[model samples]
Target: MTRNTLEQEYDIVVIGGGTAGPMAAIKAKERNRDLRVLLVDKANVKRSGAISMGMDGLNNA
Candidate 1:
């Protein structure tokens, strides 16, 4: 096994990408249009965590 290193910079880095992680990233972007926000997670954000498979249970409000 090998280790890879990443060198980068971001104004905001959200660690989870689950339930509210993505939302927080969005909100941060909305508040500051110039910010560079990065949302990271082991799984795909499209259908990760409690939602599973799809974004069906997401609160629309």
Candidate 2:
């Protein structure tokens, strides 16, 4: 097996790509366009988390 190394720097790092995670990252970047915002999630960002699992039901209610 081979090992791969990755390194990056960011002003803000948001854990989770859930409902709030993405919004928070967007807001941070809006506040400071120069900021390097990083959003990390264990699962696929697009179709994962509460939003994917029908959290919008709560909002609609």
Candidate 3:
């Protein structure tokens, strides 16, 4: 929930902040501990995926 500054330089920057964005950032960080990852999205990613909907679930949808 921290606001990232534009001046920061991340080893990997994920623009969509969707399911893939988090996955990619985690893997990248794991592979390189020194790597800095930035995830950005236009909307609240917490509510964007199927898991967040809490209904039929994302896979079923």
Tens-digit lDDT track for model 1 on 1-61? 9999999999999887567876788788789999988877777545565544466344121
Q: Candidate 3 clashing pairs?
A: none
Candidate 2, position 3, lDDT: 96
* Best-performing candidate as measured by TM-score: 2
The predicted structure with the larger TM-score, 1 or 2, is 2
Q: Per-residue lDDT of 1-61 in model 2, one digit per residue for the tens?
A: 9999999899999887677877788788789999998877777644566674665442222
- Count of steric clashes across candidates, in order: 0, 0, 0
Best lDDT goes to which candidate? 2
Candidate achieving higher lDDT, 1 or 3: 1
Worst 10-residue lDDT window, candidate 2: 52-61
Question: What TM-score fits each model?
Answer: 0.68, 0.73, 0.60
Report how far residue 8 has shifted in candidate 1, in Å: 1.0
Supply the TM-score for candidate 3: 0.60
Rank candidates, lDDT, best first: 2, 1, 3
Residue-by-residue lDDT tens digits, candidate 3, 1-61: 9997667677778766555656677678789989877767666544564344453232121
